[model samples]
Target: MVQNLNPATVQGREYLAIPGPSVVPDRVLRAMHRASPNIYEGALVEMTHELIPDLKRVARTEHDVAIYIGNGHAGWEAAMANVLAAGDEVLVPSSGRFGIGWADMAEGQGIRPRVLDFGSHAPWDMARIAQTLADDKTHQIKAVLAVHVDTSSSYRNDIPALRALLDDLKHPALLMADCIASMGCDRFEMDAWGVDVAITASQKGLMVPPGLAFVFFNDKAAAARAAQPRVSRYWDWAPRVDPDFYAAFFCGTAPTHHLYGLREALDMIHDEGMTRVWDRHAQLARTIWAACERWGSSGAFQMNVPDPHQRSHAVTSLRLQAPDGARLRAWVEAHLGLTLGIGLGMSTADDPKGEGFFRFGHMGHVNGQMIMGLLGGVQTGLTALNISHGSGAIEAAARVLAGR
Candidate 1:
């Protein structure tokens, strides 16, 4: 671990700018810092019931949501278990590591994954996906597992357009979306976009801690569940969404503190309104882009996705000269108390270890000043490390934030 050169400066509250498990708001922390409540029929039970509708609101859906006491991967497993069976085939359109992870999870559960890899830096090729679906004349593909936003590459796939393609081809495959990264940050309309099932976790844009996960599914997905041969009792969504007992919400014991924290987070999201929440993320992303574009003009710095339209508003993937990505991240964290995300699965023939890649997570509970501070820290790191970069990078970022 790199130690802070100035110990006195590292005494303050540290900022976490990684992709998931985003910065938890003070209100959410306060909500969870209490004695565990009664699990049977008191506030916790009623509150859990209330959380379902609010969670659906965030996804812009009026479907059933089953809560689980696990991380995002657990949500993926739960969704897969309910609607899909062993030997079933699903279409996975991969843009980055998260998408590939989901496909791997499906294969582990005895399902076959037909992955249409689009590398780690580009968005999905709509025509290619359409061709794959069109070729499956017998409809062996049960579901199209779509990742709404891949934080590893900071690319946002076009969900609505994919839905349109499926419609045009008259395919019978269910459209399941993995919105673990884009639920509250990006504009996701599960029902409006004709998504059959959607899964997400409490971490990321929900502004809560890791642990709690949710899987929202419509009637079509529920019918698929009914047709399944058998599902694990733990992964079953039937009892979870419509439970006879309160304990069925999360199988047995409840996630006491996480529930309290999630309730508070949902209140904050609704209070701000989804429109402003998305707008804030969009503006912050543009601010980061402005600075990165300036830096890339003169150095080895470059944004992973060339088209801004294909990028995610929650996180930005970048590349510097080999070894510079690692050096700059160390410099900022040690000296300025700011941490950035490591490049995940961005390896190439030249940079096999992905030493030249990094990411900036401008997700939940972030604002203008926080983003400005983040960019300023990076600017300082580049200068201190003697990396060749353009001037006025910070100025470019500030101009975006200032709307100049």
Candidate 2:
């Protein structure tokens, strides 16, 4: 029989360091811990109205945002449904798991995804994308689905560059970016980057628990939706854009607690200011990367994306020998109360079972001490597991955090 585990039994505060569903702030939690409120009018309704503008500020867009009662995948389906019709060909420039997963979602939606697979380690090859778009003389590809940051591989792609490519090629395809992992962590300018449609979730850098998904679309993408044959009423953004009450924001009853949590989370983001939030995430990521570099020097580990310029501020994917990654992860969680992200797309010939990979998420509600503690825990795990790693990994990370 399984032993009953109580929260008090845990030694210390547990760290959730996965790429998403990141550590929620105490304020957000306090905001969420409330009885159901009046969903029709007054505070709840007015608070809901405030969310749109704040969300747009984070997305860096003046476009319309539609909130849905779902996860990131729901955002995917909603964005696809709004702008794509059955059998419409979409060009998916895949760099990692989420990229390919988006393509799979498109396939399920009765749309043909012409995926330009760029493997799991690197960003998209612009030349290939340019050639593909250039070769499509008939312009059958209606849209380009790009993942701004692939949390699986922790690789950041160039959305603005993709948009520039589209413009240079004079392609009429709409540029849709999946910013699920990067919205608040990394710098994403939807309107300035020329993105037609952008998708993100309340988790990740937004610092809210999973439940709400947001889809932001410009006038061009809205026009495309209007011209499309049909979009499921449930997924349609037209009505949700200007809902009369809270229930209308979602299809039915409002996600009362999540909305409350989201209001507080967005307030936190705005309070810090978006630029500082981006800088904080970036600095935290760099500190982690610096430590990982030291750890990798012993040949026992490696970073999936070696280039710092291409890596994501939200998460870092690391490759190790088979079972070392898994063992280290198990040890850290079991003994040190730290949770690391799974190596999402790193299954390889030598590393079957994907046991040789893990990720470190440094996004949302994370601070320097938390990151230092996380690294210290990992270093302890490495030593306890007898995992070969260079010395002074913690010191290296500290130096980075100290701006040395």
Candidate 3:
């Protein structure tokens, strides 16, 4: 590895700009670097009790939350297992990879998914969703699985508007939001938005490693859970949230270090204030968009989502002419120690490998200078690789960061 490495990258700490498993803060790292505590009793148990409310605060929900010892996929399954049994149906309006992945998971579990693919670049068409609900005379759809922010496409769905649509049509379908990417980065009010259930993982916006996942549910979703005849033991949320079954918090021994890391991460988020954390993410996203817009002006650099309102503050997906995206990514990582996210589910007829697409993750534990450095690295790669792009991208990004 050392023989093939660039001198600049060999010394400096590499920055990972992937959508999930974002840069973990030193505080969180320190918190996790500890001896395993007794799961039966003591500070670990007490901290577990405290995490629920803090986690709820991050999701902006005043409902019950179940902590699962798994990733975001586990959270999705956990949420589905509680309210949806085998042969049940769900309405999935997919925008990108993660959305489709959730629906696929449902299908694998014997549940049917009615997917209305809105393409990878666009947000869900409200008219189509409204029409779909109106067309459902018997209300066979048990729940509407909405991905709040698809990390693949970097598009943020309008959860509140979707709730309003369900309300206007008097749809009985429960609203379940997949907030795996948007949890602490975007502004999500579960109660105010009328979302019955929401799922997220410790990775992404929570600024923790990939281990713990959370499923939050309201009274209506709880009723739906009650309606289910039988749910898988490991995926059941009732026991996880029940105070009487403390030992069953994770269906087993518990992820000790992950919980500690999550606790520290939650503390950092609270200390920064949820509103401010969201604001910071939005501003950083704008900074990235600013630079990308400048670069796109003179080249094949195009942002996936055209509308700024629909774009996710957590991540930004971009496309360049075939092979340029891959070239630039390789250049940056090898020379500047900056790793960009690979384009996910953005393939087309011309570019079958999705080599023209790449993504920038600006969520969780990111600051203005860090974003500038990321942009600077990309700019350098663009120049080094002789990729045609508009100039002054770094300046444009800096201006946005400076509030100009």
Which candidate gets the maximum lDDT versus the true structure? Answer: 1
Tell me, what's the RMSD of every candidate?
1.7, 3.0, 2.1
Model 2 TM-score is 0.97
| Candidate 1 per-residue C-alpha lDDT over 230-268 given as tens digits, one digit per residue, 9 for 90 to 100 | 999999999998899998888899999999999999999
TM-score to true structure, per model = 0.98, 0.97, 0.98
Candidate 2 backbone collisions, by pair: none
Q: Assess candidate 2 and give its lDDT.
A: 0.91
Clashes of 2: 0
* Whole-model lDDT values for every prediction: 0.92, 0.91, 0.91
List, residue by residue over 1-404, the lDDT tens digit for candidate 3: 11343585646688999898899999999999999888898899999999989999988889999999889999999999999988888999999999899999999999999999988978899999999999999999999999999999998999999999999989999999999999999999999999999999988999999988899999999999998899898988888899575589988888999999999999999999999999999999999999999999897899999999999999999999999889888888888789999998898788999999999999999998899989988988888777889988888988988988
- Residue runs of model 3 more than 4 Å from their true location after superposition: 1-6
Top-down TM-score ranking:
1, 3, 2
Clash totals for all models, in order? 0, 0, 0
Worst 10 residues of 2 by lDDT: 1-10
